[model samples]
Target: MAPIFSLFLVLITEFSLATAQQRNSNISLGSSLSPASSNSFWSSGSGQFAFGFYPNGDGFSIGIWYATIAPKTVIWTAKRDDPPFHRDSKLLLGNDGRLILQQGEDPEKTIAGGSQIGSSASMLDTGNFVLYNSRSEIIWQSFDAPTDTLLPGQKLRQFEEPNELFSSVSKDDHSTGKFRILMQEDGYLAQYPADSPNLVEYGYWDSGIKIAGNNVTLNLDDNGQLYLLNNSDNMKNLYDGGNVSDKLMYRMTLDADGIFKVYSYGLNRSDDDWKVEWSPNSVHKCDPKGVCGQNQYCILMNQEALDNVVWFNDPYSILSNTSRPDCEDECLKDYDCEVVLHKDDQCMKQRLPLKFGRQQNDPVITLVKVGGREFKKEKQSKVLIASVVVLIVAFTVLAISGVLIYKYRVKGYKKLLNSGNEELIEDVILRSFTYGELEQATNGFAEELGKGATGTVFKGLISNGKRVVAVKRLETVVAEGEREFRNEMKVIGRTHHKNLVKLLGYCNDRTNRLLVYEFISNGSLADVLFKSETKPRWEERVRIAVNVARGILYLHEECETQIIHRDIKPQNILLDERHCAKIADFGLSKLMNLNQTRTNTGVRGTRGYVAPEWHMNLPVTVKADVFSFGILFLEIICCRRSLDPDLAEAEVILVDWVFDCFDSHELDKLVQDEKVDKSKLERMVRLGIWCIQDDPSLRPSMKKVVLMLEGTVDIPTPPSPSSFLSSI
Candidate 1:
């Protein structure tokens, strides 16, 4: 029995040792991975990081990401700018030592190519994926081709060619974004917009080390210290993270907003993760050039005396004879002028694509020219006499025509009566329903769906229950309600878009006015976003946001007559059975002719969603609707109300809290524990901020907003939107 026990123990020990060896073994040549395979990824020995297929959009992408993280964070990607590969694609390390990707019998694409051949690969614990030769020497490594992140023990070296780290387009997109950090040949590290020339004027940040003929490298140590090292072995500390605990992981990243930051996360904790440990503070918040695009200037707030001033470089034309007031008039009059700088009775005019704007202590008054319409004054006496004559002639003609039409209608009615048929008033454009028919359809207004400022909505079935409809019974039959009913009918009746609610017919009988619309089955967006037991998926919210934007775009630009949806909120958006969003509630909308751009009007939206221009008595335009949609967009992203008094004091106002989180690099607070596409989330947040700008000119048109939401255009960094709120 003792001999048998010894043999059993030996055999168990050998088996355990063999298993351990296999677990730690390097990936051999000819190994492959596919999305459908059970072994889809090659993980590091500690199972902290992996290299293989990752879910991207509706397909798969070859990348390296943290395997243990709750929301898997990708650090490196192959073919970063290419569209995601299909599910049938495969990644293979060929026997000849080439890493290749094959998609459905297509030609193999080389992922990592080099002169060295016949090697193995490994997904190292340092978050680096490496290919090694027969001598165990690294031939190619992902660390050498960094994307947007630098893990601990990684180095960015400036050798024969300058090393650059481009920011990702968004949290979800690994493609190169707008900004990049370059380790210059002159031993100075600088940040610039990716599209701009790598010149000093384009650089937004620099390490200030300009020594030439020295090898420079940026390194991140395991202790959370980031530093620059030169050939003399001299180290310049960029950020000292104060020796982070072993239970924490650190990463240095150039964020999508063009802010370089060092982040830390606790390994043991799940919530409240990704804290910003270090970010540059030596420069002003708005020091980054190209943040605002051509013809735009950035406003920096909460600055010292010297920082309050704004300056533009290289004005195309300077007029020494112009006065300060004349400077503004000059820019406004000249269609080519974009901005004007005036000082000591001299006006300097800048043309389109203003460049190199900065803030400094100076006495120059900068006036920016935005778009506006000019109204020519007419002679009052001539206009009044002409109007009176036209009215007298029109009244006489209308009276004659009215009598003739009435006599013909009366004769026709008598003929119909003689024929035993009821007289019917037919409208070619809109079907006119009688009050009795609507009442019968709604079963005497028995089932109430909702109540709004104008009227109450009732759910009903018509055509013997074959068709469902919503009937909005107007409460005020007098001047105000009558005007709203007519306006809504005229505005929505002619507009046609999939995202806009369909107006079936209307009832305008005696003192009753009702609007009949096709029934939306899913309810209001507010109910789905705020009141539902389970929050809608992120994809759904994004789709709803785009749908709402398209609806507003159609109202603002695509329709025959431009319309301003004075009230655009979650409650005004209805969803159908497939969760497709459609914009409703047009009672407060305003119409504008093709020649008109803006109008002065009273505030007409919900309190929390109203644009700042309403309170300031400024001219309202389609931008007002844009501002309201901005508020609604934020609500959709965060799945919270714009104003919630039940939350903490700092978070009570959703816009303020969202901006604070965005400013502080703590956007995780906006969607705690929820898995979201970080890139799209940030893009939406930036767009919302831009839409809510205090200055109406800063708000983008709904057309551009749709383009940005659809990822067809880039969204610029936004300024503080709380200026009006703070003043109030």
Candidate 2:
């Protein structure tokens, strides 16, 4: 009878404990609950969330999650690192107010703990799980640490702090895998080291502005206004373009694939689907790690170049040959240098000659302070010399006034003739062609030999039946202007240099302007140098480069007004049937005095081939034209474009690489294109390298380039060019 009574007492004690655990909604110290209890853990707000034992793939944990959904989603977990030991898990509120997770109905398997009694857990409406201790003090909170998503009031920390990263999705999973966010020193957001620092990526605002903060509340509206909230009191408007009212709630997350996107949620959708409202880093690859590549820029991808340059002017780089409206057109065509590592390492501009009519550098000014006594002393000496010269000049002027008028008219006529008015007098050297005659002779734009960035060249036969002519229709708006047109005929018609393409006649009918020249059956120097077959031997290439240089030298020194062809490239150098080279394309050419250091105004020329000084919009000199000729000299020796994809791995820009080769003794390697003769290859390579030194002062003059090619004078040892290549 006593044994039965003992059994009943044991059963009652166990039942009483279970009932107390189930009824204890008001959590206090020393309280305990079993996983089987109906109301073991209560959340702070509406029963939308509850904290209790939850089972994952193989183990169980104490987590807080939304209970309203059909399939509950765990928002925050307590024992993430240490899961329950076995099937039996119990939740206990200890005397210190810390929540403990114990396993298997045994006291030995307690794995993890939480906050003190009065501050164990609270679920905010924003979906944050905060843990507080006694006296309503918060100890640990889920808001401070995030997993995959950002809530409404929470912040997506900036990327500045070192080693601040996000934790992985799981111990076995290395993804989302410790994603980090902190305010960067550059005041921007960057993701680093998925595997290594060399493999990191960066992101910024559409305006190219960097973001800096500990936390950010990215608020989006149906209208596309994005607000980044630093905290409850501090906030900044980030963007505004989308329709925000479309959804009740939105989420912004940084995915494992280095993709940052924003998604919208609504009241109607039970499970919110992520919509990629913005992808900040999608097109950021293939360029220098933090920079956009070459002509490739980080415009809004939707904004115009003129509009975007104002916001992000520093990274705004324009490659050669790129026009304004089509800023990214060429960049989009090539995807080679898309993902780059260093911003400064990305190639921007290359070596090219300064164009004619550019503004020259400012003159150096010397400022000195003059005392009152010094100024008075200098003034007395100037007055004495001025008085004697004035009396002598006055007597001579009285005798020569009548004679001076007669001579002035004669001098004016000579000036007009030099200005090229001689074309009006057909009896003079100048010749003219009618518009109808040229069009018919050319067969209405017959077989075009080639086209340039500016104009087209067509092969034509003259009506005389004995001579063949190549007709060029200068494709410039002012090509047929009465003044310039006459000037071209007068200057070119008078010159008779064998190295120059002969100007037979010109047709100017306002709209129809054409230039007829002695036919060169062999097209352009570019075609032969870059000839499809590559049959031109090194000696022949050397011969052609020298001939072109001689032609330009004649124009600069021998011609009446040093004619600078402003645009000098291989195509501008035409080849005759005899393979003799003649310089062509003088529409953008400039005529200036021999003594001038530079010509100012009017920008014109091809990119990559234009000199670096030209970018400053400085006045040009004959040396500028010489610079272009030098580039042409190099181009002829090496059969490749200035910018070639084949050499991208080496980052070998034509000019810089040539200079580099000169330093490394590997210059001979550039001549390996099967067509070059190994015997003369070394000489030709040396000649080419000498022509493309980065410093303009270091490059040989055209006459010298011609002389060196012919072995007339010993070529001097060029400067190391270490500094010049560094600028690129």
Give candidate 2 regions above 4 Å deviation: 1-429, 479-481, 673-687, 722-728
Candidate 2: lDDT of 624?
65
Tens digits of per-residue lDDT for model 2, 1-728: 89999999999998886555434433555655555666455654445566666656565556665565444555455545453435456666565555665654333232233322444445554566555565667665566555545555555444211213343454332234433333332323444423222111122212234333434334434444555545444655654545545644454554433344565444476565434666554223211111221221222222222111101112223354434223323333333222111112232221111010001122111111122111001110001111221111111101110000112212322322333222212223346788788778778877897777666778787634434677878776444459876876777776556678877778777776777777777778778767657446555676677777778888877666677778888888877755788888663456666677776656667765676667656656666676666567667667776666567646356777776666677766676634444435555556655655555676677777777777677765566543343344
lDDT of 2 at 672: 61
Candidate 1 on 305-378: residue-level lDDT in tens? 32223433556577877876677777777776765666767777765444434444445654555443221111
**Worst 10-residue stretch by lDDT in candidate 2?**
374-383
Q: Against the hidden reference, what TM-scores do the models get?
A: 0.46, 0.40
Clashes of 2: 48
Q: What is the C-alpha RMSD of each candidate to the true structure, in Å?
A: 27.4, 34.4
| Per-residue error (Å), model 1, residue 31 | 1.8
lDDT of each: 0.73, 0.51
| Top candidate when judged by TM-score against the true structure | 1
